[model samples]
Target: ILDYFELTKVDKEGKMLNIYLQEKNIAPDGHQHQDLESKGFFPEVEIQDFPIRGQKVALCIKRRRWTIKKTGEIISRDWGLIRKGARMTTEFGLFLKGIFG
Candidate 1:
């Protein structure tokens, strides 16, 4: 999909474009958590937030699957682009902030 969309060069080493840091683990309200519980685990895990432009922002969420590795490691991998408005990016960052900080 990256190739077809040409989001990055063909010889790029990895798909990661940027990594952000967040400080808290904000679980979706109980109802939403229950809905996705069967599909995956959404534990209240927290991490350190990154300082950007002199302001602290949310942390990176390393999504992990429990069935494969019990020791705790991010397992799921997904990447995509939403071409609409910069607002989307800002909104996403804000969402992450709400979830983490």
Candidate 2:
């Protein structure tokens, strides 16, 4: 999940009773990417009962922005499917797909 990728600064928002979130960094180091094959972590994710919508509350990660923590460098990457499910989302997937996708 995002925590595994060291994603931080989690923020939540609600518009029309829908749920949304924002985060940054693929990892705590902010300069490395994890190997999904070995880590077995998904890139995108969806969350249910986010605001306790009685089975209607949901949140999905559609994109991400990757940058160096110190230098503010934007790393170039390829396009790929983001992990689905808020509990399953990872920072790596967001960083790549956010820019390329």
Candidate lDDT scores, in order, read: 0.33, 0.42
User: Residue-wise lDDT of candidate 1 within 13-89, one digit each (tens)?
Assistant: 24322343221223333322322221253442223233456543333333323222333333332322322433234
lDDT, candidate 2, 1-101, per-residue tens = 34423332344454323444433334434336532112222354454433344334445443444555456554433323235643422454465567799
Q: Which candidate gets the maximum TM-score versus the true structure?
A: 2
Residue pairs in clash, model 1: 21-58, 21-59, 22-58, 22-59, 24-100
The superposed Cα distance between candidate 2 and the true structure at residue 70, in angstroms, equals 14
Query: TM-scores for all candidates?
Result: 0.23, 0.27
Q: What is the lDDT of residue 9 in candidate 2?
A: 31
lDDT of 2 at 66: 54
Which portions of model 2 show Cα errors greater than 4 Å? 1-17, 25-46, 49-55, 67-101
Q: Which candidate is the best by lDDT?
A: 2
CA deviation > 4 Å runs, candidate 1 = 1-39, 60-62, 66-101
Candidate 1, poorest ten consecutive residues by summed lDDT: 4-13
